[model samples]
Every structure is written in C-alpha cells, then in structure tokens.
Target: MSTVAANAPGAAGGGLEDVAASEASLRRFLHGLPGVDAVGLEARAATLGTRSIKTTAKAYAIDLAISMIDLTTLEGADTHGKVRALCTKGRNPDPTDPSAPRVAAICVYPDMVATAKAALAGTDIQVASVATAFPAGRVALPVKLADTADAVAAGADEIDMVIDRGAFLSGRYLDVFNEIVAVKQACRRADGTAAHLKVIFETGELQTYDNVRRASWLGMLAGADFIKTSTGKVAVNATPPVTLLMLEAVRDFRQQTGVQIGVKPAGGIKTTKDAMKYLVMVNETLGDDWLSPHWFRFGASSLLNDLLMQRQKLTTGRYSGPDYVTVD
Candidate 1:
C-alpha cells in the first residue's frame, strides 16, 4: 500500500515507479476506484442542465464562463499569425467593452507557445501548449517526452498533454500512467516553478463512462494539475454529461487526497448557454472554489465568441452578431 504519488502537487508518496510496485497492484488500485453508473450520471447532468438562471445570474455565469476559456487554435495549418490573433482575442475578447474579463489562457501547438507568450505579455493570461504528440499520441515515449520538454522550454505557462489512448486501450495501464508522470516532470522549469499540466483522456474513444471515471482517477494519481475530457479532434466531444462526470471526479479526488485538481471540458461547447450548464455543474458538484478560472476551464475556441455575444446582450439588452466580436 506504499504508493508513490509522482506529480501529485503536494501528495505524500515516493516516486513514479513506487506508486504501483507491481502490475497487479496498479490494476487493483485502478479497479478499486468507484464505478460509474452511466444512467445515473447522465440523468444528474440532465437535471443540473434544467436549473434556471435569471438575468443577473445569467450575466454572472456569462462572465465567469468567459474567464474560464482556454482560447485555442490547434489545427494542422495553424500559424504564428493565428496564435497571435488568438492571444489578442484572449487578452481582450470584447474590443468595444473593456469591462469584459480576459480568458484564462491561450492554447496553441508547442511551436506557437512563444508567439502566444509574446503577444500576451504584461497580461495575466497564460500561454498553454498541447504536447506529447497531441491529438493522436501514437508516437514513441521519447518523442512524447521531448515534445513536452520543448513546449516547456518555449515558455508555456501550462501544458495540455494527451494520454496514449492506444496503450490504454491495449491495457498497458502502467505505460499510460508512467507517461503522465514523465510529462509532468517535463513541465518543471529550471527555476523549479513548473507549468501546470492538464492530461487529456479523449473520453469519446475510451467508449464508456466507467473508463472516463478510471482515467480521471489515474490522471489525478499521476499528478495532473487538471484532468481534461477531450482534444476536440474527435466527433463526440465535451458533452455536458461527460463534463459533469469529470466535475464529480475532481470533487471526489479533492475530498480523498486534499489536493484540488482542476477539470476542463474541451471541444464542441459553442454557446453561452452550454457554458452556463457546465458552470451549474461545477457550482452544484464542487461549489464556488472550483468555479474560478484557476480550478476549471473550457478548452474552446468558438465558445469564447458565443460567450462574448451573450455578455454583450446582457449589457446592452440586445443580441449581437459576428461583426461585433473579433473572428479568431
């Protein structure tokens, strides 16, 4: 039972290799995690989605959602121009309204991290990079670890890394676990102040609510500062039900270890209404502490625009269009 909690912010454990002295112990630890009742999970999310918020509450939720966005551009054809523009957008989402809160960070490919960092200078907005071969994670371990180190070197304030779903699906659980540990270590800067890490599970491919739950615990145990739901590359991404389940995981993890890991729901969440539903889930499940940008985030690109528009409507009492908001 002597666990090594590598990457666990303040956890008391030995090291990565000691967490599970044997494969059998790792399996026992993962399997012993509480099971997910898919039906109940989905039903609870639906019920939380039904909670009504009036004008003031809606406006507050809109602003909170804005602050929680990791304004992202992770396309194959992404460029410095795109990353810089996204950084500008993240810093001042609403040009007409300076009252608008800035997003938590600008998310980009590892190569674009410096561009984003330069563009967002003097602002608290962080520059995050997606590494570890990103969306696919089919590359070799050395390649993945180098990918993470390169991002950290480029001044990424945070790293969003994808787990090797291939290994996880193949039942190489320790491979997946050790990979997270290595990537977390890669986040450390020479100053010893490391970039925060968010581990993506690609829940859609995992194919079951139970798998998502297990992945959540696994990431937490591996020392992920945040557990992310998806990469937005997949067809099914960031559903309210899946996100709600993740919120539950963070809440439970905090209760057990006293380490409050963050949660992020990436992809397909496009509207302020959709964002509010997630906020409701957080408020209900994890309470006010996790409601801020520090503890929660929306790994989104388009979600920022929608939130801006809604914030405009709440301010001016009229709906706005694409013309008013900057197109990233």
Candidate 2:
C-alpha cells in the first residue's frame, strides 16, 4: 500500500525529491528509518554462511556465481592488452570447457571501456566502467558528470559511481542524493536508453551498519539501478554482514516502492565459498528473484579463477590449480 508515483524516477521517501528538497528534510527522512540491530544482523549472516549445500547444489551455485561475476581489473598498471585479455577470460572463464558460463561483465577503468566493448562483441556480456573519479568521490560535481558521460560515450553498458563519503558522513545527504541522480542522468545514450547505474558506498568507510542502510535507501531513491558495496580499493570492501544489511534495505525499498534494485558485493570476496555464502543470503532474504546477474553481481577477479577451479574439480574430479586458471 505504497503511494509512490509510478512515473516519478526520483521518488522514495514517500517521494525522494521532497526528501531532498532541503538538507533538514533529507536528514529527518533518513534518520527516521529504524536503526539497525547490529548483533541480530551479524548473527543472521553467520547462520546463513554455515548452511551446507549438497554436492549437486554446490555445483549449480558455482555456475550461477560464475555467471554473476563482473571480472574486474582496476590496478594502476592496466593497459589495453590487459583489458582485451580480461575480456577474453570473461567470455570464457574456463577456456578448455565451453560449457562453463561466461561472466556477466568485464569491469575496467573508464578509458578501457571501448576496448572491452569491442573485445566482447557478439556476446551478451556487458562492459561496465568505473567512473565519477572512481574509488574516491573527491572531485567536483561537473567532473563526476563528465567522467560518467565519457564512459557512456565510450560504450559502457554500466557505470559504477562512488558516493562522496565526506558528504554522507557529514550529514549532507542532499548532496550525495543529488550526485547519484545526476550520474544516473549522465548514463543516457544517443538511443535514449541509459546505462545501468551502480552506486558504490564503500561500506568499509561508512563506519556503521546504519549508514549502509541509509546509503542503500538514498541510492535507490536517486535512481540507482544497483547499490554496490565497494570499489575494491579499500582495506575492507565487501563483508557478509554489511552486504546482508544492504540486501534488507533493497528488499524493504522494493516492498514500499514496487521497484527492484540490484545489490553488488565487490572486493574481498575472493573465494567460491565466500560467493556461496552471499548467494545463500540473497536466496534466504530476497528469494530466487534476485538470484540472476541482472539483479546481483560480484565485482572480483580472483573469485572467478576459484569458481573455475571448483567447477573443474566437480566435473573432472581433480584440481585445476592456479597455473591452469587465468593470472587475474
């Protein structure tokens, strides 16, 4: 029984724009939301992590996690050749086995988007670029928008933009909200369609589970297609409890607004077991609806190699090891 305007892209605090009309109103709306129960959230995530999957189920989860990966290469030394190679691995995580699933996208710096887009041609894989002064939102507003516009023009299918932690932490919620809204608009293309907008909160720096909840709501209200956990450049990127809290925010937001938003847990998720724990949480919290790559994504490089190794073990009953997998 929500009254959200169906056509209002910027509506969510009963109406997002109204909430952002003034910094005071935005603070009231965000703070009015119930506080997070940290102990309860952590216990639930821990319990879900221990849920054992049968062999057959683990195999299926492996493939599903593989398909949901945004095989990323965000190092300072990344070059065009490296990006093309990353795209090739994304197209086939297990080159010896065509039956293996391809990754959802090849995530790279904005400058590398066209190379990735060309390398991934003739495939359904998306080209996701990190923009808006990625990993840090310290730049000015126009700089962020121009960064987004360049990526979109270079053929990025998705734009991952980081929020200004300083603004959010200092209670400048409207500034953060407006930035997300503007970035979403900048994702537009010549065909009138827009690239998917994934807002990165860098949960490690947010300092509290409550802020994670608020950021989730704020991003959704600002027209974010997905709420990502991090940029993978921080000391602590994605953690189960933090990601679980984000999932709850999206679930509640969807219930009140009737709009579905995606969740991405980037950084530190470097193993198949870690990925499985997240998939379990998603299923238990949001059901099978959020299980698809269109609704969920893993922003990792090493995680994909581990998934492929585990897949090989399940199929051939032997370890493929790192030597056999891609160097990423």
TM-score of each: 0.94, 0.96
Model 1, 85-204: lDDT tens per residue?
888788888888999999998889999988888999898888889999889988998999899999999998888999998888777777787888888888888987788889999999
- Predicted structure with the largest lDDT when compared to the true one: 2
- Best TM-score among the predictions, by candidate number: 2
User: What's the C-alpha lDDT at position 163 in model 1?
Assistant: 94
Window of ten residues with lowest summed lDDT in model 2: 1-10
lDDT of 2 at 210: 89
Which regions in candidate 2 have their CA more than 4 angstroms from the true location?
A: 1-9, 13-17
**What Cα-based lDDT does every candidate model obtain?**
0.84, 0.89
